[model samples]
Target: MKKIINEMKVRLPSHSENEAVARTVVSAFSALIDPTVEELSDLRCAVSEAVTNCIVHAYRDLPEGEFGYIYISLRLYDNREITVEISDNGCGIEDIKRAREPFFTTSESDERCGMGFLVMESFTDRVSVKSKVGKGTSVLLRKIFSPHTSEEE
Candidate 1:
């Protein structure tokens, strides 16, 4: 069977729209993969973290009309692995290493847990981030799914 790639784009004001967007994106993938409840939750959490980062960190200084954009792409490989890419054209990370550190956050004023990257890494098979100080940021995540089965081989 041929692999399938699905993509979506969303423009949200900020945290207010985060949950809705995440749900919609994940639901789309669930339709094709039929992921278990736990798998679906993991996917939603990863996407939520990525989107939240874009909303809170990216475009931090821009005013209301400036806007924020999220581009999500999902690719399913033979019903085994799913690749998700979330890209934002906003103020990129100056130091990805620092950003990924557990409990280390630049948003001290906002009381953020700073566990976004860590959670994403823990749930996905592979996680990669590419960014330029002033250009933008793109987070690529991949996860492999195995069907639930019980048998003695």
Candidate 2:
């Protein structure tokens, strides 16, 4: 079992405004490894996409003013590995495989590019999803920081 270096769990309202909140918290938590600017930017973008999914898709059915909650957890492990989990307890996804395909948005509008999973996968070493209809979905993302990567090569 890998020991945890540090961790935090937060429950935020699934609101468009909280996207920035999530990004801020993620940036601060990820600073421990002193990741390169590019690496940090990638992580932030991935988090944004995940959070937006929770707000846009998961809670889509909520009465206009009503809102669901988004759960976010950040963990740092002993081996320079960081894991971020974003979850929601709202209407869940019906299909995981098809939803992951590029340009596959369920939204009727053109706003959603259907690239959330791809973005997360591109920015992290691993990305996993779990969902149950009416039970919501959770996206887990893992990244291993390597500042010397450029120097070593």
lDDT of each structure? 0.78, 0.91
Per-residue alpha-carbon lDDT of candidate 2 for residues 63-110, written as tens digits (9 for 90 to 100): 989999999999998777889999999899999999889888998854
Overall local distance difference test of candidate 2: 0.91
Clashing pairs in 2: none
For model 1, which pairs clash?
A: none
Highest-scoring model, TM-score: 2
Stretches off by above 4 angstroms in model 1 are: 5-15, 148-153
Q: Measure candidate 1: CA RMSD.
A: 3.2
Flag regions of model 2 displaced more than 4 Å. Answer: 147-153
Error of 1 at 102 (Å): 0.1
lDDT of candidate 1 over 1-153, digit per residue (tens): 746655445455555466577667666765676776677778778878888888889867678666767777777777567877888888999889999999988886697999999999988778999999778899998887777454623
Using lDDT, give the best candidate's number. 2
